[model samples]
Target: MEPQLLHTVTGQVATVVIRHPAKRNAMTAAMWGSLPPLLETLAADPGVRVLVLTGEGGTFCAGADISTLRGSPLEAQRLAVAAEEALAAFPGPTLAAVRGHCVGGGAQLAAACDLRFAEEGARFGVTPAKLGIVYPSSATRRLVSLVGPATAKYLLFSGELIGTERALRTGLVDEVLPAGELNGRVAEFTGILASRSSLTQAAAKEFANGRTDRDAHWEERARESGDTSEGVAAFLERRTPRFS
Candidate 1:
């Protein structure tokens, strides 16, 4: 069967599932091409507050579909890079709920996400070295930012897969859960994110992702949003803050 990128929205959370189980959810060029527009559509929806990216079947993405590499390799790489950029640039919080193999381009997609929750058996690697290809500079920078230059170099240079424990220790994954607990934990966390103030989250996300300049309108926007006041009121009333 052909590879597919499937999406669904439930309340404030949107999920993008990589479905190519025959190749361990390996991403095809077409799947890469589809990502940016899919993310854009989700971003435009006011109801969607967070995105969850995962794979169907037992495993996460393996990498670029090697079959496509025999055709237009450069185009496949370009599309993959574009998709990675789109995920990295997503305005809202994004999480990767990973299991099994997440290697090469799959690792890139996970790195692009804000957080990653992985099953204990999950494996991660960056393997362009094995294929005699250059990993994109943006992806390299993002990987370095996540796990530092030395560790990033270790993975890129060796093309060796690491277990979930090493991934967590290296900061590649935020949390490690049992295979059965992964989805529930992710849903629980995203629910918390969705219930919080979007304005605050957006501002924090921007600043945390290396926005050095002060956003001049931040204070004004915050004040107008009334989130602080609502938060304070909620605290006093001992009720959940209703963020619009």
Candidate 2:
């Protein structure tokens, strides 16, 4: 069967699942091409507050399906890079829920997300070196931003997979939980994110990603939005703020 990128939504969270368990969810070129449009639709939906990227079976993405590379390498690279950029540019919070193998392009996609949570047995690596391919500069920069240059080099240079403990220690993963607890913990955290003020989250995300400069317009827009007033009122009244 061909590889697939599956989309499913529950409440405010949308999940993009990489599906191809026969190949450990390795993505095909077509799957890579599908991501940007899917994310754009979700981003435009007001009801969707967060996105979670994960794999279909016990494993997360193993990387790009090498078989596809034998066809058109240039096109495949373009699609893959486009997908990674789209994920990184998503307006709302994005989390990578990882398990088993997350190597090469899988690691790049996870690095693009705002946060990553992994099962205790998850393994991560950046493996272009193994194939004699240069890692994309944008991906390398994101990796460096996440784990710092030395750790990033270690993964890229060696193409050696690391366990969850090492990933967490290097700041590659935000949290690591036992396999049984991963989903529940991710749900708990994303629920909190969904309930928070979107205005605040958007501003913070832009700043943290270094995509914008500090300006008076940001504060002006926030005040005009009245999100702060509602938040304060909700706090005083002991009620959840109805943010739209």
Maximum-TM-score candidate: 1
Candidate 2 colliding pairs: none
| Structural similarity to truth (TM-score) of each candidate | 0.97, 0.97
Off by over 4 Å in 2: none
Judged by whole-model lDDT over C-alpha atoms, candidate 1 comes out at 0.94
lDDT of 1 by residue, 1-244 (tens): 7789999999999999999989999998889999999999999999999999999978989999998998888888999999999998899999999999999999999999999999999999999999998899999999999999999999999999999999999999999998699989999999999999999888888898898586877788888989899999999999999975
Evaluated at residue 105, the lDDT of candidate 2 is 86
lDDT of each prediction vs. the true structure? 0.94, 0.92
Residue 98, model 1: lDDT of 98
Runs of candidate 1 with Cα error greater than 4 angstroms are none
